[model samples]
Target: MSDLVDKAKNFVAEKIANIKKPEATVTDVDFKNLSRDSVTFNAKVSVSNPYSTSIPICEISYTLKSATRMIASGTIPDPGSLPGNVTTVLDVPVKTPYTILVSLARDIGADWDIDYELDLGFTFDLPIIGDITLPLSTKGEIKLPTISDFF
Candidate 1:
């Protein structure tokens, strides 16, 4: 009886391992806007769903870190849905206060840009598999917007 149960478990595990899941990638991160109190950066994420039906996104959680400091972290609830059988690009806006940016002046002094690591989680429900979170991360430099850009 023990041998049969072990064989059944192995078979189930193998099937689960072979299941196809949605693929996601962080395409780009760029400066989006500059407000009076904060700066906004947009992280572009591309998610390709393998299923034929659109999957509703439960939440999009993000963390922006630079110079070992967590600049911003938040969750966007019920943003939208991922299109089926295609790659969908979603923009996650990360807002950081001017005070935090001021603290990292040394890193910005070299090139007037922020070297950041952005972590994003794309949460969606899959058929028969429950909720699956596709994690995507990207490291890059975002050139700061100059005062001249506004003018």
Candidate 2:
């Protein structure tokens, strides 16, 4: 009887270890809007769902960093669902106040751009597997608009 129980436990563990999970990637991060007080950027996330049916997105959490300093961090609650057997693109808005940007002037002044790392967490509900969080990160430089371009 003990031998049978051990075999059952091993089988279950192996099955769980080989389970197929979702995959995600951060495609791009670009400036979206600029206001007097704040600047907004959009992070594009593409997620592939393998399940047969749509899965509910629990939440999306993100942090934007520049020069090793955190510029902005926030969470989007219940963003939406991922279509089954296909990839879905989601936009996450990151807003930074002018004050914060002003503090990072040195980095921006060097090349009229900001070097940033965007970290994103995508959480989804999977049947039987419960909830899973997929982490994606990307680093790049974003050029600031020139004064003439604003016109």
Candidate 3:
């Protein structure tokens, strides 16, 4: 039983480490003259999981911070089960460059490090029969147009 938990945790950690960060390339930036509003475009993040296991639910979180200030944050479901490759679009108003951190948490239970005594919910009839947490994390960047560059 303990072994199973360790295996699950390792699996999740590896998967999270391998999960690719969202790639963003400015496809188009439209700034109207004399207007502060600008339309910034970038590709949505795409995450792929090759594990042949069923997860009750998968949640992905995105946090963006700039100059020690949190600018924006959001979360979306992993769309690997869908038909397409699962792309999420983010249309952010460029105020300044920011650092983006993306993390994934799932109910797979294969990668969770759970203390059997403390975690009552996961102790009974464990699906994977192991104490494991499958949370993973990665990060990327979004370059905001400088004030002078916008003009």
lDDT of 3 by residue, 1-151 (tens): 9999999999999976675332222233332233334222233323232333432223334443323444444444532231223433333232212122111112113343111100001011113333233333333333434568757
lDDT of 2 by residue, 23-66 (tens): 98888888889988999998888888888899999999999999
lDDT of 1 by residue, 1-151 (tens): 9999999999999998898888888988999988999999998888888888899999999999998899999999999888879899888999999999999999999999999999998898877878989898889999988889989
Order of candidate numbers by TM-score, starting with the best: 2, 1, 3
| Candidate 3 ranges with C-alpha deviation above 4 Å | 1-43, 53-57, 77-151
Q: In candidate 2, what residue range of length 10 has the lowest lDDT sum?
A: 16-25
Q: What is the TM-score of each candidate against the true structure?
A: 0.93, 0.93, 0.30
Using lDDT, give the best candidate's number.
1
lDDT of each: 0.91, 0.90, 0.33
lDDT at residue 124 of model 1 (Cα atoms): 89
The local lDDT score (0 to 100) that residue 119 gets in candidate 2 is 90
> What does the lDDT read for residue 122 in candidate 1?
83
